[model samples]
Target: MPLPTDTYRALTQSVSAELASLRASTPDVMKAFGDLGRAAMADGALDKKTKELIALALGVAAHCDPCIAFHTQALAKLGATRQEIDETLGVTVYMGGGPSAMYAASAIKAFDEAAGATRG
Candidate 1:
């Protein structure tokens, strides 16, 4: 079954508190991580949308729920359609096999929720 519409959002919110604490304790490391993320997602040969898609796929493959949530939210804001998300999930599953298939479901739920949140 798909996750609840608010699940990913809630998960992200919960993670944010812990992440904030970690960042407070490890400011330099957190800043470096944030910088890396910004640099990786910057528009270049590939646009931010495409980069987000790749990141979403990798997030699913890695079973990283927060990554999936963040990237799906990014993808939705970037105007990614459901078809695009599904196609990316297809590639993610093919590359990462059964485990990825599990997380891909969550990824789509994340996308849908984020898309709806943007609209509402």
Candidate 2:
């Protein structure tokens, strides 16, 4: 399904709330997972923006709608241009094959939606 412009923010907010609840319920596990994600995405060899694009490509490769939405918004917020996103999608399509191509399209739709959101 094509991603609606509002869906990205809604999904992210919903997920954030759910995750916060889960963190309270399973503090140890959630903390570990959250810490790991933060650590992996932190600036080091690659900047945060690069990591976000890598993550966005990974989201497409994995065919995770929520991940695509989340990463699309993150990439936009980090100032990724269309060219960079297209390049990342190219690699994603190459690595992930036919299925990834479909998801990559979805990712693009989500990215456009996210970009629109920031404008207004």
Model 1 regions lying over 4 Å from their true place: 1-6
* Candidate 1 weakest ten by summed lDDT: 1-10
Per-residue accuracy of model 1 over 55-112 as CA lDDT, tens digit each: 9998998899888988988888999999999999999999999999999988988899
The number of clashing residue pairs in each candidate reads 0, 0
The 0-to-1 C-alpha lDDT of every candidate, in the order given, reads 0.90, 0.87
Following a full C-alpha superposition, what root-mean-square deviation does model 1 have from the true structure?
2.2
Worst 10 residues of 2 by lDDT: 1-10
